[model samples]
Target: MKLIIAVVQDRDSNRLSQALVWEHIPVTKLASTGGFLRAGNTTFLIGVDDDRVEKVLEIIRKNSQVRKGWMTPHMGGGNEGDGSYPVEVQVGGATVFVLSVERFEHF
Candidate 1:
């Protein structure tokens, strides 16, 4: 069996969850926060057979998308303690990890 852990931005959570449900893929959603941006995120836990890993990944890939964002750094620039400008950043994507599970149980 495989345990899939997907961490996705909050903006895409609802849509992703809906799509997974539409495919009859069971998922457990947990509220999460991103460390870098301190932004809202969602963690989805899915357990599936080894052969279904690719199918689950395909669903997640179709739902989660990457987009641009802006964030200001805490450090000052140019010998001044105040030139903290917001920089365009890549955000809104899923970080997924697939792990082998020797045993899994549900109640």
Candidate 2:
């Protein structure tokens, strides 16, 4: 068995979750926040057989798309040299981790 952990932007969470459900892949969703951008995110936990891992991954890739966004970083300690401007950043993608499960049981 494999455990798939996917963290995706909030904007794409709903669509991704819907697609997973449509494909009959059970998923658990949790509210999360990104450390870098302090932006809203959603974490999905999916348990599936090894053979089905690729299908789940493909669904995530199709639903979560990478896009550009702007963010104004906090400059600690008021300094004259610190530029407080919105910088373009790449966002809206899923960070996934596949782990081998020693045992899985459902009641």
Candidate 3:
């Protein structure tokens, strides 16, 4: 068994969930927040057979996407009125972790 942890942006969560369900992959979804942007994120916990790991990863890769956004970054001890500029940033991607499970049980 393997444990797949996928942290995706909220924008992609619905689409990813639907794709996973279509592939008959069971997932446990949790609401989470991203550290960098402090934006909403969704965490998916999926337990699957070892051979199915690649399939699950492929699904996540296909659904989660990276795009650009404008952000006003806080500068040197100043407020938003302190001449802040909008910086283009990359967002909307998934952070995935795959681990080998020693055992798995369901009741």
Candidate 4:
């Protein structure tokens, strides 16, 4: 068995989840936050047979999109009137990890 952990941006979460459901793939969704951007994210826990891992990954790739966004970074050790500028950064992509599961049981 394989465990697929997909951390996707909130903007793409709903669409991705729906697509997975449409494909008859069972997924557990969790609300999460990103450390760097402090933005909202959704984590998907998908357990599937080893043979189906590639299909699951393909679904994730098709659903999750990469986009650009602006972020204002905080300046450290600055004066009272220090100003922060918005920087363009790439976002809206899934970080996925596939792990081998020793055992899986459902009640």
Against the true structure, what is every candidate's RMSD?
A: 5.7, 5.4, 4.8, 5.4
Pairs of residues at least 3 apart in sequence or in different chains that clash in candidate 2? none
Number of clashes found in candidate 3: 0
Worst 10-residue lDDT window for candidate 4 reads 74-83
Sorted on lDDT, best first, the list reads 2, 3, 4, 1
Q: For each candidate, what TM-score against the reference?
A: 0.75, 0.77, 0.77, 0.76
User: What lDDT would each prediction earn against the true structure?
Assistant: 0.88, 0.91, 0.90, 0.90
Please give the lDDT score at residue 32 for candidate 4: 98
Segments in model 1 whose C-alpha atoms lie over 4 Å from true places: 68-91
lDDT (tens digit, per residue) of candidate 3 on 1-107: 99999999998999999999999999999999988884899999999999999999989988886878888787555765877898999867899999989989999
List candidate 3 stretches off by more than 4 Å.
Answer: 68-89
* Model 1, span 1-107: residue lDDT tens: 99999999888899999988888889999999988874899999999999999999988887786777888766544555676778988766899999999998878
Residue 66 lDDT in model 1? 79
Error of 4 at 65 (Å): 3.0
Q: How many backbone clashes does candidate 1 have?
A: 0
Q: Which regions of candidate 4 deviate over 4 angstroms? A: 68-89
| Candidates 2 and 3, the one with greater lDDT | 2
Clash pairs (backbone) in predicted model 4:
none
Residue 89 of model 2, lDDT score: 83
TM-score for candidate 3, please give it.
0.77
